[model samples]
Target: MESEIGAFVAVATVLTITPGLDTTLVLRAAASQGTRNAYATVFGISVGVLCWGLAAAVGASAILAASPTAYTVLCVAGAAYLIWLGIGMLRRARNRGRIAQTSGTARMGSTSAAESALRSWSRGFFSNLLNPRFGLFYMAMLPQFIPDDAPHFLMGLLLALIHNAIDVIWFSLLILGVRLMGHWLNKPVVQRGLDSIAGGVVIIFGVKLIIPVIFS
Candidate 1:
């Protein structure tokens, strides 16, 4: 069991550090909105992860894996959501750029902290939940770590908690790093650049997700 946990941690750590949608979203939020919003995003993503883990433990994810229709529906929804988010970012960047040119200063539109946090959290949650890959991943990868004698549901939850812990630690460090550079990051030029880059990357991912389904 100890070995199993060690092995799970090793693999989960690699996955946690990998640059992906979650990482991109968190970085963008931290740099643009501040650490509080970023933390909210992380919390939402963690909840999504736990839900997937629970689903996988109870064999619900297998249904997603097994049914083409179900998978395709989720794939489409997730892709659309990502694309919408990316386009929104791109629009904001354009607006900011225009404002900067006209007034010699750029400001990304601001929202109430509560509003921003809620939006960020919802985006994070739905983005994670609607991602079929998460379901597939938990279904496929988690069982490998379960001991023969262990309760599958409990073990899965445990593994999920471990994964979440790793994610929190890594993202906290990332948020801190971003905070340290807040001065420069808050600059209009830098903010616009990051928005454009993050938006483009997210759209690319969304397109990638949809293309496979469309062609298949």
Candidate 2:
């Protein structure tokens, strides 16, 4: 059991550090919106992760994995959502000047800030939730760590919690790192550049996800 846990931790750590959509979203939020917004995004992602874990524990993820129709539907939906989000970010980068001008208006600025916070949370939540790959990962990989003597659901939840803890710790470091670079990241040009890069990466992943479905 101890050895199993150690292996799981080792693998999870590697996964947590690997650059992916989640990392991009969190870093972009920290750089552009501030730590509070980034943390909100983190919370949303945590919730999504928890949901996936629960689904896997209850064998719901098995159904998803087993059903090609269900899996394809989820994959397509996730891909479309990601592409839309990427395009929106690109559009924002393009209109940064106009947005900056609008921010000077007090009433609109406050409303925009509130909306932005909610948007960040929702974006993080849905981005993680909609990705069928996450469900597949939990379904295919998490069970290997469960000891046969232990209750499957409980063990699964515990493992999920461990994964979430790792995520929070890693993301906290990322947020701090981004905050440290606030001086440079705060510059409009730098912010736009980050947005462009993140948007492009997300769009690429979205396209990659859909290509199999498109051709198959």
The TM-scores, one per candidate, come to 0.93, 0.92
Residues 131-204 of candidate 2: C-alpha lDDT, one tens digit per residue? 88889998888888888898888887888888889999999999999878777787778778888988998898
Error of 2 at 140 (Å): 1.0
Question: Model 2 TM-score?
Answer: 0.92
Residue pairs whose backbone atoms clash in candidate 2: none
Candidate 2 segments whose C-alpha is farther than 4 A from its true place: 101-112
Clash pairs, model 1 backbone? none
What Cα-based lDDT does every candidate model obtain? Answer: 0.88, 0.84
RMSD of 1: 2.7
Q: What is the lDDT of candidate 1?
A: 0.88
lDDT (Cα, tens digit) per residue for candidate 1, span 1-216 = 999999999999999899999999999989887887899999999999999989988899998878999999999999999999999999978877676342212222454678878888987898899899888998999999999899999999999999999999999999999989877787788888988999998899899889989999
